[model samples]
Target: MVQQRSVTYVNNTTPLSITTKELDLENCVNDNQVAIKIHSAALNPVDSVISHAANKWLVGSSLKTVGMDYAGVLVKRGKNVDPKFQIGDKVNGFISHAFGDQGSYSDYLIIDPSKQSAIGHMNNFDYLDDDVKARFSDFDINASYPLVFGTAYDGLFSNGQLLNSRSRILVNGASTAVSQCLIQIAKKHLNVETVVGICNSKSFEYNKKAGFDHLIAYDESNCLEKVQSIIKDKFNGQKFDLIFDSVGTSEFFPIIDTILKPRAEGSLYTTVAGSNKLKYTGGLKEYVSVLPLWNYAASWNPRRHYNYTYTMVWPKPAIMELASLMVSKKQFIPPLDSVYPFEEFQTAMDKLNTNQAKGKIILEINKDY
Candidate 1:
């Protein structure tokens, strides 16, 4: 048994609390699991949503932790585990807590091999690309990349399939961490030619650096009109072949038909963020009502030939491999906004709640590690 400090859920409406607890290593660590001494963890919007509305979406237990991404050292490994993973390897990955009650908000986390894990070992620092290695030498920045990059890769390439070089793509919520990665992957990996990003003026500089061909600021009242006008002029009235919406507001639902290619084959709209209402509201009734509303709106227009899909990232080995390769090749740079100490958990949550972070926010769990 080992005693460590961890953050645990108090209730649905209250914030998470930190406390000392005893973990039975013998029970938690199995033959197919890897035992890690977590050093840092990153925050995501999904953590806030789940913490606020756990009663409706989460099942199994009342007490839970509230994070998904972690970076740590592999202190122990199971005998049956892969020999490639040795002790003291520097690693980072994400653990989805959608179905389970446990999460990564602790000093120690047990990663099961069966789950959709995105674990990556970074001990071979000498093998890293010179440019990437020059920019980062610690775990804090590496901790922030897994979830955001994995989500973006899955949404753009795996599910959306924007493979054609001539495809014109539009990315909404371009200021988001995931969107930043999507823009780079679309340009570098898919060899996409025309890529436009919709974001506020504050994010214009960052989006430009991320390799967006065109940018539309959506902070003003006539933002939609401006977007339409940009499409008319820049694209010569040709609609987008693919629209990726990281912002799931109802506003875009009405204008989707106007911007999307009419009756074009392989045209698609994919969103990682579900309905805005479902993300904020609590209780079963509110959850039930939001689903039908989306269904009705999506099916209302017959002329909208493009298919609509709501996607959740399922981390796989291929996605992680792609991300790792990009990082090693100096093609992808992980954007890390801020790093907070583990004791200031509430402050970290407050920053994420604002939803204005330019990149990922991380928590340094064991500074001395």
Candidate 2:
């Protein structure tokens, strides 16, 4: 029996449960599956948060393994695998095996395209234009981006229904990875008029360089006054058309009307970090539950006064293609917070949980690749 090294949760309730272990890999890939030799994988706050509360969602089976984003070489493929995928192609994307039984934090990962796993996407970024590529200078960008980029894409286009020239967005927790992706996409691709970011003093300059037209220091006194002033001075007093919250706090809700446009203007405020401190919302018998769409459902209720929702990123091969294309076109490059070796996930998670990463956090899974 063949075995491979992987990051697995010995139990579901603590980051301490996360550790590297070897597991049997014989027959891991079915005839329709593909296996990737992971060069790099990304760590998201969601990855760590879920583990502490994972048991509630894990069925009676001892579901292990954890991680989502990865980029690497397609080392093996089942005979019936899609013809578009070749054995030696560079592939990258996400796999959500019931929140993670077959995760990306491994030397190798096998995924089946036909099944729905939490949020799934698997594709290759053919970075063909080396001549023009800048910050996308390495393959690791592929691993660092997918999950957060997808979240931003879905938030702005799908949920926010962002009206290009007219939309003005305020990114709460703007220094977070997903918010960084938002800054790039909204300012560059969508050409939104005014993009503002709310972050602490240390990140003000970085957020500005990331394309936020204005940055407010949330740590400063009268942060709300600063927000109102920016709107009055830069945007003609128009309230934000969309507010993307990564901080996961309800503190802004009470003052919602002061910052966000009314629900009638087709405005929205969506958050991923709802109730940041996590506890299991499920029980022992629960087998599967996707990111709760109940929050999204609430947004559609006629009597609901606020247009808000909790969003979960979805798979769109187009997003992968777009990131590659933009980088090749010399448009903009995705930024990185830091890269850790495969052995240092705990340190990475510690940094992530603090919510202060300067950019995306990635694991250098196989440095040689």
Candidate 3:
């Protein structure tokens, strides 16, 4: 057993508490434990969201760790871990297993074998390659991209019922990580008939390069009307087949309702509204599904959409498959705003909390990694 330094939230709100403790390297049963020599980790808005509101959900528990994504080399493994992964293999994963202690805000962390995303095949140490080692060095950034993509991909293809060469696709908050993934996947991979991105006018050009064939600025008094006019000019008065709204504010819904094609076979995917609130309106068939990243089993919002919500649990098998595919196609790229050494963890958290970083923030734990 080795002692691992970790970050924890002692109180329900504000200010953080970082500390260290002993973590067992063994004693893993049924493959419920994994020891990671954390090389790097990323911060998501959910951290702040949970920290501020988790007080209500508390059962008088004092321990709370806030982190969802981590990437590193496997230092130790519990028996029954996917048999294909071994010590020293590079991996990246999202932690959605039962919530508290399993979070990734630590020097070393454990992920139940069921929640890991395997990036490479394991081999006897002697047979590993320079490229694989080099690849592992960037796991932090590499792993973050998948979480964004998995959310967008699963939401679109599965929940939204989007298919290849379908009608126009509208993506609100197009410049976001999830939207970026949607743009690329919808345009370059799926080849939708039209890909439109809606955002502030200032970011229109940026959204264009990210994959939106058409960019709409929703800042005007008649922004919805403007969007409708643009679609008419472009698609000969056609309606959108799918709409993905990453920003869930109330304003977005009216815009979606106004521009969404009436009675068209399509859906509106929103990350802001949790799957529990998945709803429909105006005789428009909108499929709403939540982003389930914990269990592999697909559950539903139990709403009208009846969306088969499957958890994108970073299971080793799915992770390896997606990673290998991305590597083969050269798509495992992380959009990094900056990287901070492990010692600057507080600084990193501050930047993230302020919403100052435009892209993912990476924290390097080990100097050599």
For each candidate, what TM-score against the reference? 0.88, 0.83, 0.78
lDDT at 178, model 2: 85
Give me the candidate number with maximum lDDT: 1
Clashing pairs in 2: none
Per-residue C-alpha lDDT of model 2 across residues 220-296, encoded as one tens digit per residue: 89887888888788777789998888766566766778889998889988886663423232322221233435656
Model 1, range 1-369, lDDT digits (tens) per residue?
988777877557555788788888666767778888888898888777666666634454556777888888887777777777778888888887752456777888887745746887752335545765554446776788788888888777665464668888888889889898888788888888888898988888888988998888887578777778878988788788888878765566578778887645677777777555354325444445444355447645776566777667776766668877877776777776787888998898888877788888888888775
Q: How much is 359 displaced in model 2, in angstroms?
A: 1.4
**Cα deviation of 216, candidate 1, in Å:** 1.3
User: What is the lDDT for 270 in model 3?
Assistant: 38
Model 1: pairs clashing at backbone N, Cα or C within 3 Å: none
Off by over 4 Å in 1: 56-62, 99-101, 123-137, 277-293, 296-304
lDDT of 3: 0.59
Q: List lDDT for all candidates, in order.
A: 0.75, 0.71, 0.59
